[model samples]
Target: MITQTISLYNWTNGVIMIAIFGLVCLTLIGILINFMMSGKKKDKTEN
Candidate 1:
């Protein structure tokens, strides 16, 4: 019973970690996309 409890805790911890990592990756991609779009707009205006 104790081992089962410990395994459950570990499983939940891993899931939370993965969720956080995925969110961070998504945010980074969004920022990169925003930066690229803005850069393109600037170049278009300058030209």
Candidate 2:
């Protein structure tokens, strides 16, 4: 029973870690896109 519990804990933790990593990656991508768009706007105004 203890071994089964341990296995379950590990599986859940792994799933949680994967979800968090995915969320962080998405956030980083969003920030990068926003930065690129702002740069484009700045260039247009300068010209």
Candidate 3:
């Protein structure tokens, strides 16, 4: 799946691929952080 995505980006010479991957990674990281923080908040509130 990843290889196919990279191959598709080959048409754009990799610039768009890099940008897309960067944004995707950042979004994923942000979502993970948000989940962790929300879980912590819920635990504290239950106490």
How do the predictions measure up, each by TM-score?
Answer: 0.70, 0.69, 0.61
lDDT of 1 by residue, 1-47 (tens): 99988887787789999999999999999999999988865445766
Clashes of each: 0, 0, 0
Q: Which stretches of candidate 1 lie over 4 Å from their true place?
A: 1-9, 43-47
Q: What C-alpha lDDT values do all the predictions have?
A: 0.88, 0.89, 0.84
Best by TM-score: 1
Tell me the tens digit of each residue's lDDT in model 3 across 1-47: 89987776575767877899999999999999999988865455767
Better of 1 and 2 by TM-score: 1
TM-score of 1: 0.70
Q: Cα lDDT for residue 46, model 3? A: 61
Q: State the lDDT of candidate 2 residue by residue for 1-47, as single tens digits.
A: 99988887787789999999999999999999999988865455766
lDDT-based ranking, best first? Answer: 2, 1, 3
